[model samples]
Every structure is written in structure tokens, then in C-alpha cells.
Target chain A: MSWVNWILVICMYPFVLIMYFCLKNEGHDPKKRVYYGVSLSKEQAEDQIVTEIGNAYKKQMKRLLWISFLTSVPVLILPSFSIAFTYWCFWFLFVCFVFFWPFGIANKKLREVKLEKGWTTGEAQPRYTEIKEAAGIRKVKWYHFLGPVVISIACVVWAVLQPRDGREAMLIILAATFGGMTLMFAALAFWMDKEKTAIVSSDSNVNVNYARARKNMWKNFWVAFAWFNTLYTVGILFYQVQESEVTGMFWLLLGLYILFTVILLVWVIQKSKALEERYADKMDLKVEEGDDAHWLWGMLYCNPKDKHTMVNKRVGLGTTINLATPVGKGVAVFLILTLLSMPVLGIWLILDDFTPIQLKVEENCLVAKHVTEKYRVPFEDVREAQLLTKLPNIGRNYGTSMDNVKKGNYRLRDESISCEVLLNPENGLFIRLETEDEIYLFSGFDDTETRQVYEAMIK
Target chain B: MVIILQDGSEVPVFKQIRNQIVMGISDGRLQPGEKLPTVRALAEEIGINSMTVNKAYQLLKQEGYIMTDRRNGVRVRESFRMTPELPLESKEQLKQLVSEARVRGVSQEEFMALVEEYFSAGQRE
Candidate 1:
């Protein structure tokens, strides 16, 4: 297999690993029955029933694994789509079939087992009072915000120092976005830090330690994210300087980010588990299930009671919006619109390869048209129009190019003349038109059309 | 001070917040001139509507229980004086309480003691 194919295979590893872990750890899930009100001891027959349930779960999981493996073969072997589409398919299958289906099944089975064995009890005792009010904002040191402040300053400085270029401008925008996000995350961290139990527990020491550890983890995660963003911004700038396409480096960086995220998630889960284990003896295992029911898919919080647009996830992993609120709904709509626009963008990009560029010399003007853009040059404003046998080294101001076809506004590096460019690099007339205000660059994609358009324009 | 909103309560959320703050100040749980959280901060912390919290703050400020400054968002009024005029609703509530005490077959001395207990309860803290 080629190196590209190897990268593709490697990219599939995370999904495989996630599926393996999900299936492998199914048996180890805590069997703590949330029996409401009445506390019941394990009966002699309960063990047998539990064992039966466990065995059934394991069997079902194994069967699912085999089925999933068989089903994925076709999808895996299917001709290459976009990498994003492939990864999305893997994720969708894992979530919908492998994870969600089995999880729902097990949950249903567990409920059924509890009901059959007469283990279910009365209504849950209210424990909202004991759930503890989150303490007010804690005093945050100035240094906690230093990383975001520094990144913000650096982004501003970089943007100000860099010469005006579209690619450079995009880089600066990305950096600014990253810096803004970092600052928001930093602010969120400080806000979340204030969440403490109102009731002083007998295990205050352990609680303090746990809180500290979690806070430190959050701080480190944000700092790491900031550094990663900085490096990525720098990478893009470097790629632009090298005059190289960003696709390969972009994918590599994205892959690294995904890998890092999975590792971070695993680390957080482990740490949280350790904290829970240490405090299990001291703290009550059950409490008021505050707003847990409103959460859909264990991620999206849809609480109308929450006034804030953004909130920390219950798992202390990341932020989630209260989607019931107007602001959250707006964000959700914007995100959906962005996602929906991707296909149109992809189609446009693909069409650029096939779309024929046409330059029509009419009675009063010359009209240049491509799939992505069109430009009209008035005869009155056109100062000079020339057809060159060979094109100069020109950079794209804003347009599309694939292999031999280049059509857009371009800047001539040697002459420093802005022009309309419509050129097929292989075999086309390089038409450089200098209008009164600006230069119009055009290059035709077809060799015949190029010669015809050149001859027509010159005549 | 932490404000807990009862999900099942018949009272509206804004009223609950207002009542709680009033109770806090009367009982000295919230001291005179104590700085209260910003409306937004409190709203976020309690996971309640900011408008509800703002309404509560507005009520408190109007009643001379709290004061607001440009730099310091809101605070318990240092003057800490109750309005001279009591609302008719409060008067009616007091009348109802007295009538209830009389109907319950309690002596005037016992009723007075009960009233004294409640009034001093706020001063204990």
C-alpha cells in the first residue's frame, strides 16, 4: 500500500480502539443499582440473575462485534470518498450501532431485571438540599490568565507586523479566533473553579485535593490547547512562506489533534475514576440528579432553567451549551448552516476542475467567466491587452486553480502589475489586460479557445 | 449568600430570590454593607434567569435593603433602614397572624412570647 493509504489506515485506528475499549469494558461497568428509598440486600438468587444478565450482555456484545466487523467490510473497501466522510462513517457506525444500541439494550435489560427480581423501590428521596450549592466566584490570581493574554498580544503583533496578504490575513484571523477562545476558556475555568460543596464534608481534605487536581487538569488542557493553536498558526504561516499547499500539513495537524484529544479524554476519565474511588467511602454515592434528564445523548444540555449560554459539561471534560436558550439555538443554527454549506463548497471546488473558462469579446466589453467567478472589462477602461506565449510567475489574489487551469485576479511578481488572469498553464494564451483602475488577468483552459480569444482580443 | 430555588415551590422564582435576600439581611446572615454578587454572576451560579435576579435586585434596591454603585455592582445598604410605610398586604398578614394566635386558644403572653422569639431570631446571627 501507498503512504497515503497507510495514513488512511492509521486514521481508522482511533475508531477501532474506541470500539474495542467500549466492548471490552462492558462487563466492568458498576452494577450499583439505584434502588429508590428502600435499601435492599443482595438475595441468594440475585447473584444467579446478575450472572445471567452479565453473560447475556457479553454474548450480545460479541455478536454485535462480529456483525459490525462483517458489515464494515463493504464500507471499508468502498472507493475513496473524502477523508472526512470516511472518518464520519466510522464514527457514526460506532456511535449509532456499536455504542448507543448496545448501551440502550443493556440499560433496558438491567431495568427489566431489576423489576423482575422485585429490586425496584418507591420514589426517590429528595437530596437536593445535600447536593450543595456551588460557592460564589473564588479569587483568581492574575497569572491564571497570562497564557491567553500573551497569546492575544502575540496574535495582534503578528497581524500588525505581517504585510497585507489574503493568506496572511486568514492566518491572523485564525490566531485571533484561537486567542479569543483561549481567553473564554480561561474565564470559564475561573468561573468553574468557584463550584464547591456548601456543606463541609468530613472528607474536606480529599475534596480539596480532588478539586485541585481537576482544576490543574483543566488549566493544563487550556494551556496545551493554546500552544497547539499557536503551533498550527505558525505552521500555516510557514507553509504559505514555502509556497506549498496546506492540505497535507493541515491533515497531519488535524490527525495529531484528534490523537491528542483521545489521549486527554482517557487521562481525564482515569483521573476522575481515581478521584471517585478515593472519595467513595466518604461521600454519598447517590444525590439529587440535577438536570441530568435534560441532557440528550449525554452531551447536549437542554435546560431552560439555565440562563447562561455556555456551561461546563457535567463530566468536567468540556463546555456544552444550554440549547434551549435563544443564544444556544442561534449557535446551533449557525453551526448547522456551516455544515450544510460544506457540500456546496466541495461541489464548487470539484467543479473548478471541470468548468471551462470562457472569455467572450463582445461589442463594448470582454467578459471572462468561470464556475467560481466572473469579471467584465469595459472597452473604454481597457488601456492595454496583450497575449503572451508564456506566462510569468503569478500568485492568486483570489480564485481557483487545478494543475494547468488558472483563472482569477493575479499579481505579477516581477512587474508588480495587478491583472485579470485566465491561463491554462500547459497550453493557453496568457492574456494580461490593464484597465484604467486595475489590471485584469485571464488565462484560458483550452488551447484552441486560448488562441481564438487571444486573436479576437488583439483584433 | 447562596440562594436555592425550589423547583416545586408555588412561589415564583423572582419572589423567592427577593424573600431570601430579605430574610438574609433581617437575620444578619447577610451583613450590613456586604457586597452581593453581580446579577449576571448570581444568575449563572444559580442557573436561573438573569432577569429574575435583576427583578429581585430592583425590588431590594427600591425597599432600601440594597444599594448599587457604579464600581461596586450591588451591596446591602449601609444605612440599613426599613421604610416607614408598610404595605397593606404586610399589615393584613400581621392581622391574620394575630387572629390565628387568638383562635388557637393561646394567651396574650404566650402570643407575645412567640412574636418575640421570631423577632429575636433575626438578631441572633
Candidate 2:
């Protein structure tokens, strides 16, 4: 019902739609001559069983698409963000597992059909690369890095110039962060330009042209991302300089940035597919290099024999690591753990937001509590305590900021920093307690309760 | 121009690279003074070790089949003479091949004719 809830729904819809469409078109794409990431000859791919299996997979994907999209509708009317946040986190893990379930099923079925029909592409086929295609002629020029490098340096300069208020420092660091991000894109673009492209066609010219087209597309994507970083960095700097309200502006910038990134990614994927199809279309659908044994369920690539750490993914748009390598295994474990911990993250968010802030006098100490994070100051140590009608213009720096609960380390607009805070801002009352070494702000569930705590603390 | 490498081949990767370039030259697909990819570039392209490619390039350079400089990277030789006398290694290998062909009922004249057919392309170029 709230604006924030609406934002959540809007954000989720596009993601699911894109995932659905991409997976829908994936595996059995005639252009790539791949059926469920399995390399099959034209005759084998066109078999009756293949069609029946592919259609069955399509039907299941359509059902999943509806389920994914329809589930998002319920979040629009969710009373609180905690429940919605929890749902979204779980939903992410669900989609990650469920969407791929269909792929895995389809891959297994197609691979079975491939074997049963005596259509096995050889396990150890040679990797063919044309010399002219490998020639590093169309390299990323040195000048292409100039703008992003300059921006990164400028960010550091801006950070150095800014006043060292905690929030102001964060804003300055953000400029540099954007600089780092932009530079990363520049580097990635450069590296990708140099990386070898997949050989799709027997014709060297066609293969060479396809590689060039794909490289150009990736280069454009990185360039776009670099510019995006600069633009968003400017917006953040503007907010910091103007000392403007963040609620609406933060959401607007963040939403637009996410939406822009998604659109760019989708365009890159679709364009790359088109280019491959255009060139590879001319080639006879002869089985090229096939490593069906290394690809687990046609999704996970686990080839130790591969010298390269990263390999072109058989099923998807991007590259995946060779999981048999040490670094690859570490990354895999980290990713799996991160996905598995989403429910725990949702729980943590709930506890941070829903737990009531307790402000009470115990043994002459002004004790503030929220879950395990607590701050206690002796009344004798409190140098000054002021009861303010309104909270300061502040933003979260390191802790939780919920709609009702604000329990965090925060920074004010005046370049000042609050060390500890546990307040419910809707009560419209706060106790700004200052000590020799620390600044603490506390408020209770209601204004009356906060007033009592303030009266007791000042006594 | 398409350099294909079998993953499970008994030949070392560097040998595979070296042999392919030699065959390409023999077939005239790769011409005299034609630019080859840099060691790093070729290694990355083929998903092999740079050291492996370097060894191949080193062998090619030692045999006067290719040349390398900082500016030009690596390239086929501007012109290299095809000597009539084969190296001891090649002669040994040729003897083995001839014996195999003789055992397989491919007469010496038939094998010589096959050899002539392969050499004729480069000779014409």
C-alpha cells in the first residue's frame, strides 16, 4: 500500500519477466545449434522426440513465468516492508532454484534423447580457431581508457577536498567508489576485447565477423556503464552539496540505475545472440567442439583439464568459471552460501526493524537496547541531555533505517556524526544525550514513554 | 587458417601449434611474412598457457620459419629456402612413415606421389 511497497513490486516485475523470456528462448535455440545446452546435429535436433521434449519444457516455463509474476502482485498490498523484504529474499532464492529446475530437466531429457537416438557428439573434439580472427588488430585503443581514468582521479580529488563530516566523508568516498566502478568497467571492456570469441561457423570470415560484432557490443556495454557511474556519482554529489532530503532522491536514482543496468544487459544478450545466429546460420549444423561430460546437468562446468579459468557458458549469456580449479571452487562455495543465507538475512532484517527500542533508567545508567546492540551511559557521565521536539536531518551510515525504527550510527547534515542511536521517529520526540566521549540519541515507542526517559536521564 | 587442436592428442600443445603453422605454410594458406598473433594473444585465444605458445614461437624462430620483434610481434619469415636435405629428426620420422606405408601395402612410388602432391601447392606458390 505504501510507496516503498510499490517500488518493490515495480523492481521485481522486470527481473522475472526478463528471466522468463531469456530462459524461454534458451536451450534449443536453432541459431546456436544447441538443444538444452547439448550439441546435437541438425537431424538429431529435428527428431520428433526432441520437439515433444522441447515443447514440454516450454509449457513448464510458461507455468513458472506466471507463478513468478503473479507472486509479486501480493507484495503491493503487504502491510510492512519487513514481510515484503523477507518475501523478496525468499523469492530470489526460489527463482534461482526453480527457474533452473526446468533447464536442468530439459537438459537431462534432451541429452537422453541425444544418446538414445545415436546422436552423440564426440567427447574430445578439437577446438578450432582461425588465425585471422585471433589477430589482435581491433584492440581497445589506449585513449578509450582516458575518460574513466580521469574520472577516477577526479573522484579522489573531490574526496580529498570535502570536509570530513562522517556523512560528508561517505559522500566523498562514493565519488571515488563510482570512480573505481567506472575504471573496472573500462578494464573489463578492454580484457573482453582481447579475449577469444567462440568459433560458431566453418567459414573463417563469418566467425571473424561474429567475434567483432560481439566484441563491439560488449565494448559499448562497458562504455555505457562507465558513463552511468559518472552520472550517478554527480547526482550523489549534488545531494551532498545541496543537503537535500534523501528518501525520494535516493529511490529515484537507485531505481533508474538498476533499470538502466538491466536494460543494457538484456540488449547485450539479445544482440550477441542475433550476431551469432546471423553468421552461424550460414554454417552447416555439424557438431563442433563438444564437452558434454564436463558440463554437469548442462549448467555447471567442472573441467580440470581446461587451462583457462573462465570458459564461455554453454547455456547462458555470460561466462562461468571452470569449477575444478581452486579459485573456481572457492567462488562456487561462496555463491552457494550467499544464496543459502538469504533467509537468514531476511531474519536479520526483521529483527533489526521490528525489535522495539528500549530506553530505561537502570542503576542510574541510561540504557538503550535493540536486540543485542545496546548502548548504556551513566547519568553522571552524561554532560548534557536535551529533549528535542524533532530529530535532526540525518541519514544512516552503518546501521538499520526502517520506516518506524531508526537504530543505527547516523550522520547529520551539519557534517556531524551520531555514535549511537535507537529512536522511533514517528513519536516526534527524542533525547539527545551528550557525553564526554560519545553522542547518543534515544526515544521510546511513544512520546509519553520517551518523555519519562528524558526526565529520568536529566535528573 | 583454422588451427584445430585435439584436447586428448598425444602431441604436446606447443608441438600442435608448431606443426599447424608448418602445415599452413606448406599448404600456402599462411603466406610468407604473414602476421601471426602475439604469444599472449594466441595463448589467450586458444585457452592455452602463454609459455606453451612462447615455446612454439621460440621453436619457429629457431627454425627460421618466423620472426619476432617488439613492434611487429610475430610473423612468418619474409622468405625461407626449402632445403632438399631433411634434418636428422625429420629423416628418422620419414623413414618410420615409409616403413608404415610399406607395411600397409602403400608402395614407395605411391607414397612418393602422395608426398609430391602435398609439396606441389607450396612449390607453385
Candidate 3:
């Protein structure tokens, strides 16, 4: 396995736990009016059957969490990074499916019991908003996005003006990273401002204050995100330019960044939940007319009657698209397609890693090939071909870097560029073939095969 | 200004909007010259069709309850034209109401008492 595999595996186990807790947090909220994604009255929520269902769902998720942990054990021993990476992808999806499956089941059961006991919250959509609150300027203004946008733009410009070498690809990625995150935050701010401020009670003051507080919290979050990304960009770029792994500094900064990000996310989520509790603490469903029926699986919001495309999520921190409108349907289709493509991408990566690298001598020329990557250098242009047991700090500029395969353009720390079509770096053998245009690093499937190919080329 | 919409109510969405706004005015919750949300904004806020809110606004404008213009958007009328007689619509409603009260065994004295209490429901100065 490679460093990428190790990083992903480390990140994933904690993620499973995080997802579990997020679902657990969704249990009972006056703002949401649901238990396990099922709407119920205060009396029904306390019913023996309802309590039993909630516990059962929890137990099932715990079992799935343990199972997910166990399955990852096999991934550690997987032969290559490709296998491990593929297993991790599918395993993550499996954990997600199994985790949500119990919630969906519990939701279904609770809904059934609600119907049988006549304890429905009520059949209400986004059907109410006070007049004054509707017109209240309780939104984060557009200028709230200005700070982040300006910082990210400066970062992108800085990246662009950096000296152009063969590292153009690397710089472009840096620019894209900063620019993309800025755009995302800006869009999020805009989308959120456009959403209707929910009327939690008859009091417009409470509603207005609640809306303003939430908007301010998110505004702070986006601003913090900008600072975080800026620091990361500066740190990474400094290291790249120096052509040295300030490994200790890089790791420390990365660790702190991740820590801060997690804390910020958790803070926002808790603050939002608290804000709901503070404002609508006395909110109680008086009739069977609840919003549970409008949500699918207690997660997705779908109300055909709601003209707005974006609606507040029933469970999580962010908003979800309504599945009733044309835009909502389009978003749903896109998400479904994306979910379906995960496994396909995993399979494709595995195939790419397993594809053998071939070095052939033909017609006074040498060709090193792996998958779709082919590098041919005429004997006349080939200045040198040297076999080595180790490579330099060959960082990828724009290429594939799987455990078994490394192909396409790469660069030495602080150096220009090289084209590599190498397989099985674990074999501890490689060939440095230099041509007029660029350097080529290559190898065969094994030491013996590579040595044979090198001898033939020399002859 | 809180209005709980009954989607299953027989009242059309536009009528519900109009009724609520009119009630708000009479209840003094809506002040004269107070700006109202645009047709699109109110419709989106209430999660209904924009045209529904437009129709309500058009009705309100025609009845001189509200006004609309390019610069002002929509707002409650500063003052309404005072007439000595009740509108035909109110007359019809009053006719139905009195007939119901008579059938329900309400004496003239009791009916007039109720009328006095409601007529003086001027909670706002």
C-alpha cells in the first residue's frame, strides 16, 4: 500500500463514527419534529413502541459500525494500494448504505405506528411565514462574501504570477483549489440568503432573531474557511518552491488545519441546534398535521407545494434541494448518478494500477508503455539509458501515482520535468532514459524482466 | 401578521392571502403606508405560486386596500376613501350574519351588544 492508502484509511474510520453521531443527534428536535426521521407527537414520542424502535435503530447502527471497522482490517493486508483504495471506496459506500438502511427501516416502522395510533404531527408543508418576518432583512448581506473572495482571488493571482517552469500543472491546481473554494463559499452564502426564513412560532421577533443568528454563524464560518485555505496554500507553496519536504512543518500545519476545521464544523452544527432549542423551546405539535410526510427517509425534503427549490434539511446542518420542483428533480438525478459512479471509478483505478508496463526495442528506437501512456525515443535522440535501484523525490505534476504504476509527467523537487511509465516500483529497479525533449523513468513488472529489457536496449 | 394556511381549506390560495391581509389591516397589525413583500417574494415565502400572490395583490389594489408602483413595489394604502354606506360585499356578509343570529335565537339586544363589542375592538390607537 502507498501513503495515499494509509491517509485514506486513517481518515475513514473516524468518519464512520462521525456519521453515526450525526444521525444520533437527529433523534429529537422541536425544530425538526421527528424521531428517527418519523414525525410524532410528544405523547407518541414517549410511547413504548416508539422508544423501542429508536433503541433498535441505534443498536443496528452500532452493529454496522463495528462491522465496518472489522471489514477495514482486510483492507490493511490488501496486496497493493489499488486493491486497498478500491476496497476503501466500496467499504465506505457500504457503511453509508447500511447505516442509513436502519434509519430508513426505523422511519418506516415509526410512521406505521404513528398511523395506527393516530399520532401524526400534522400534514404541513412550507405553508406559513409571518408578514413582517418575511420582509425583515434577516439575511447575511452580499458583502459578507467579499473578504473571502478577495483573499482567494489574490491567492490565484499569486499562483499565476509564480515563475512558469514545467510545474505549470502544479501551479494551476493551486489556483483552482483556492478559486473553487472561494466560489463555493460565495454560492453557499447566496443560496442561503435566498431561502425563506422559517416561522418557528407566532412571534415574528423570535423568528427574525433566529434567522439573523443563523446567518451570522454561517457568515463567520465562511470567513474562517477562507483564512484556513489561505494558510494552507501559503504553507504548501512555500515548501514546493523550496524543493524540500519540511515534512515536520507541513504535517503540523495540516494537523492543526484539520483539527480547526472539525471543531468549526461541530461548533456550527451545535450552535444551530441550540439556536433552534432557544427560539422554539416550547414548540409542540398540537395536531396530526406534521411535516414528516413531506420528507423522504427523514433526510430529503420533498414538497411539491413549496415553490422554493432550496429547503432546510430535516436532519443535517445544510439545506437540501426540494425533490418536487424541476431544479430539485435535476439535483436528485445528478446525485443518484454520482453515487452510482463511485464503484465504476474504483474499478477503473484498480485496472489502471494492474496494467503492466512494457519496454520494447524496435526499429532502432526504445518505447516504454503502461496503459495509455507511451513514450518513444528514437535511438538517435536517446543520449543515455542508465539502470538504477532507486529514484529521487519524483513528485507528480500531472500524472497517475498508484502503488504499482507511476505514469505521465513528474518532476524532481526543484527540478524541471520528466515522463515516467514505470510499474512495480517495489521491484527496486528502474531505468533513466533521457531524450532530447524530456527525461523518461521506467521499469518492467519485476527486476529480472527489467534487467533483460535494459540489456537488450544497450546491445 | 401570522397566518396559518390550511392547504385542504376550500378557500382558494389567493383568497386566503387577501383575507389575511384585509384582516391584518382591520386588526391594526398592518399599518397604513407599511411596505409589503413583492408578489414573487411573498409567494416564495409562503411556498405557493407567484401568480396566486399577484392575483391577491391585484384584488387588494383594486379595492384600494393597497397600492403598487415601479418605485414603491407594494404597500398598504395611506388612507381609504370613506363612504357612508357599507360595500355590497360587506352588506351581503352582514345580511347572512344577522339572519344566522336570528335563527340561532339571538335577541336584538344581544346582537347589538355583540356588535358594540366588535365595533369597539380597536386595540390599536
Best by TM-score: 2
Q: Interface Cα RMSD per model, in Å?
A: 6.1, 2.0, 2.8
Calculate DockQ per candidate and list them. 0.11, 0.53, 0.46
| 1 or 3, greater by TM-score | 3
lDDT of the structure predicted as candidate 2: 0.76
lDDT of 2 at A20: 78
Candidate 1, residues A111-172, lDDT tens digits: the string is 56656776554332221211112333344555867755686668757865776544455556
| Per-residue accuracy of model 2 over B1-125 as CA lDDT, tens digit each | 67888888889989999999998887777888888988877887787778999999999999889999999878899888658688899899999999999999998799989998877866627
TM-score of each: 0.63, 0.86, 0.84
TM-score of 3: 0.84
The digit string of per-residue lDDT tens for model 2 on A1-459 reads 767667656766777877877777765666557777787767777888888888888899989988887777766776777787678778777776677778889889887777776687556877776677474635566687787678667866877786755555566567777778788788767766765666666566666776677677777788878877877777677675664556756657767787888788788888867765666557543435367777887778887766555666664576677799787798789889989898888788888777888888999998888888788889889888899898888766556677788877776657555467788877789998889977877888789889998887666
Across A1-459, the per-residue lDDT of candidate 3 in tens digits comes to: 444455566666656776777776665453545677775656667789987998898888888888888888767778776677678778868866767788788888887888888765444543566667574554566676676677667767777787755566676687678567777767766666677775655666666676677777777777677667766676666665555444345335555565677677777887877876676664432222456787787777787777778776655565778889998898789877877687788787888877877877778877777766777778788788899888667766566765567777677654555455455667788888887777778787788888987898889
